[model samples]
Target: MNLFELNQAYRELEERDDLDLETLKDTLDAIEGAREVKLDSLASWIEKNKMQIDWVTEKVKDLQAKKASLTNLNKSLQGYMTQSLDDAGIKELQTKNHILKPRNYKASVVVDSLDDLPEEFKQTKTEVTADKKELYKVLKDGQEVPGVHLKPNRGTVIK
Candidate 1:
């Protein structure tokens, strides 16, 4: 209600000579008590909502950090795996098994035996054929066959 309406209502109540003073005081007290109850209820509602808001906020932050860590871990693993494939000569295995004869060898040995390999078998190419006549000749001449050189994990250097 507008201020004028409220003022009029108060004036009317005050001018009511029929109502006893005790009854008027009791009614005013009841209105004040109701206002207090409403305020208290509103405070409780805010408190409850705050608990949920705090919990959700914490969970969101934790998830964000975990996501970042997972992403970094994935990238690190990808890089490590690529290095492993390169070191292990995975490409040579695939090409040799699919297109070349079964001369079981590692990448380093295959690279060193480049002279013995046929033009096609030196690496992997479309026009490649392996003629191991030279490789066998060298071995037959008592020269050690060129193979993958594997040293002990920890040992004296042997040149």
Candidate 2:
């Protein structure tokens, strides 16, 4: 039976007290068996999907490495072309589909030493966070903490 049917049967069996003990036990066993099968099927899917995820992750890493290599090559070729154009004193070159020219960009700020930077040019950031481990210890010892409370963690493991 499907999950819904199995659950319905379990609920119905739970609410009934008229059946003989043997029949009740058998019915509950049947429901439990169905649920077990469903769990097994679900776990199997999880295992298969996990394998696929690992494979895709590896593929993505490989592709990323290739892309990085290509990007570096592109940068190297562009740098070489730009340097060659500069050596030749070529201000601009026009092709059928494109025009290549050097243009000036705004100067970028480079920080040599943060400590030596002027105070007015520097900014400070502060962060505050709760100490969860310490809080857990206190809460677990039956002490109350403001703004937060302990919660029971429910989790499942499959093998």
Candidate 3:
């Protein structure tokens, strides 16, 4: 059934006193051919595995590039937001935060991008994304866009 069994059987037949030299030579050739086929199969399997590994490596590189791109974009956006928020009352529009009598409001730097959005923004996306209810736009009132909370609420007071 297996190579060893087949080899053992072949050997037993070859040791028969009447066995001819031609027959022995033919059997040895056949066994060598079988070994070649097995080796070819192993080579093919290694080639396929190598291809798979190469493909996965390229995929990992592409993902890393995408991550780097996003990081660069976030750094750019954050720097812009900080400068904009600082000069908002005179240059850019201002973000409005309201503290009801019992609550004191504080305005902190926040972003709603792919990576750095707050847990509150991620959880209540419907409230944050609606047109009139954005989470982080500078306002005119300083305009309060519904329920969005900004940090450092005490910017240049609106009069």
Candidate 4:
């Protein structure tokens, strides 16, 4: 039976609080039979569509790899084109289908190490963070630090 029909049946069952043992058993048996039919239909549908699912999964992986390859190629070509334009003293090149020009971007600062910077040239930004791995190690060694505590977490494994 469909969900609506099953729900109506359940509602009828719920209203009859004085149902005899035989009547309750029959109702339960009907519900279980309907559930088994639904499960069988679902399993059959999945089996029929398994091949299409596998094909789509493979195509997605292939497209992702191709996208990564194209991205790398674009970066390489952009660098080479930029160098060629700079060397040839051409600022911009326009064609019917495309326009090639150099776009200026903000320069980025590269630092070797934060510790090597002199105090005067460096700005200090303090951020407090908990090192969970180190904390776990300390707790495992039977030691506790102030302001830190371990808590148990529970989860269900569905398999």
Candidate 5:
């Protein structure tokens, strides 16, 4: 049966707690059988798709490496072209297919030393975070910190 149907059956059985031992055993068996079938189907799907997934992963990695190489080559070529133009005492070059021009350098802040940083360029900001391990230690020591409390959590693990 499907997950929904299995859940509904389980809920019905839970609501009626006076079920006979034979009936309970049969219901347990059915649930186990359904779970086994679901597991098998999932395993089969993974087996079928694993090779294609690996291939796509490899392709993506290769493309990323190629893109990085191309980016580095482009940067080097651009630097060489700029140097050549500067050496030729030209600001712009025109060709049949392209025009090369140097863009103006942007202004940026450069700090020579932190101690020498201007007050006008400095700003203050506040950040807040909790240290869970420390907080747990304090709680375990029977001390309370304001605005901090622990709550019970629940989870399930399947094997």
Candidate 6:
């Protein structure tokens, strides 16, 4: 029987005063054993999924590293081609299937040091955040915080 049905049967057995001692004990033991088996099965399923997640996480990291390397290589190749074209004094080259030309990009400001930046050129940002650690300490000591309260949570740990 499933865990829920087994639990119901066990409860029903408790309310019955007509069963003999031996029969009552045996029935409860059987229900308990069934529940144990169901729990073990569920825990095994959780463990299997966790293993798959770890494997996929590692694969994703490897793929990201490979992509970054390929992107850097592409930038290097483009820079080399641009340099070659400029050295050859060619404004544009027309091939059988493609036309390659150097184009000017819009000018961008480069910052070498933040310390040297003028006050007018710098931007200030302000952020507000909750201090959960301090909140926890205050709440545990029977203090009150407006619009905030400690919440109780439960989690299962499998080992």
Score every model by TM-score.
0.34, 0.64, 0.35, 0.42, 0.45, 0.70
lDDT of 6 at 49: 71
TM-score between model 4 and native: 0.42
1-159 per-residue lDDT for model 3 (tens digits): 577765565556535667577975565556543665544434554566678899999999999999999999998987776565555543344347632122224977655474676566565333434453333455534766656655665532211
Candidate 4 residues 1-81, lDDT tens each? 677776566656656769898987776676744665544444544454576799999999999999999999999999999
| lDDT for each residue of candidate 5 in 1-159, tens digit (9 for 90 to 100) | 667775566556656758898987676666644666645544554454677799999999999999999999999999899989999889989999999997668887788887788889888899998889999999878898999887878853332
lDDT of 5 at 38: 47
Prediction 1 global C-alpha lDDT = 0.59
Alpha carbon deviation, residue 132, candidate 5 (Å): 5.4
TM-score of 6: 0.70
Clashes per candidate, residues 3 or more apart or on different chains: 1, 0, 9, 0, 0, 0
lDDT of each: 0.59, 0.79, 0.59, 0.77, 0.76, 0.81
CA lDDT of 26 in candidate 1? 64
TM-score of 5: 0.45
The residue pairs found clashing in candidate 4 are none
Q: Find the candidate with the highest TM-score and give its number.
A: 6
Q: lDDT tens digits, residues 87-154, model 6?
A: 99989999899898977789889999999999899999999999999999999999999988999989
lDDT of 1 by residue, 1-159 (tens): 454654454455545667787986664454323454534433554465678799999999999999999999998986676666677766533453453222334655335666776786555548676456876666667677657232336733222
Inter-residue clash pairs, candidate 1: 120-128
lDDT of 2 by residue, 1-159 (tens): 767776566556546769897996576566645566646654665576789899999999999999999999998998898888899999999989989996667988999999999999999999999999999999999998789899899965778
What is the lDDT for 49 in model 2? 70
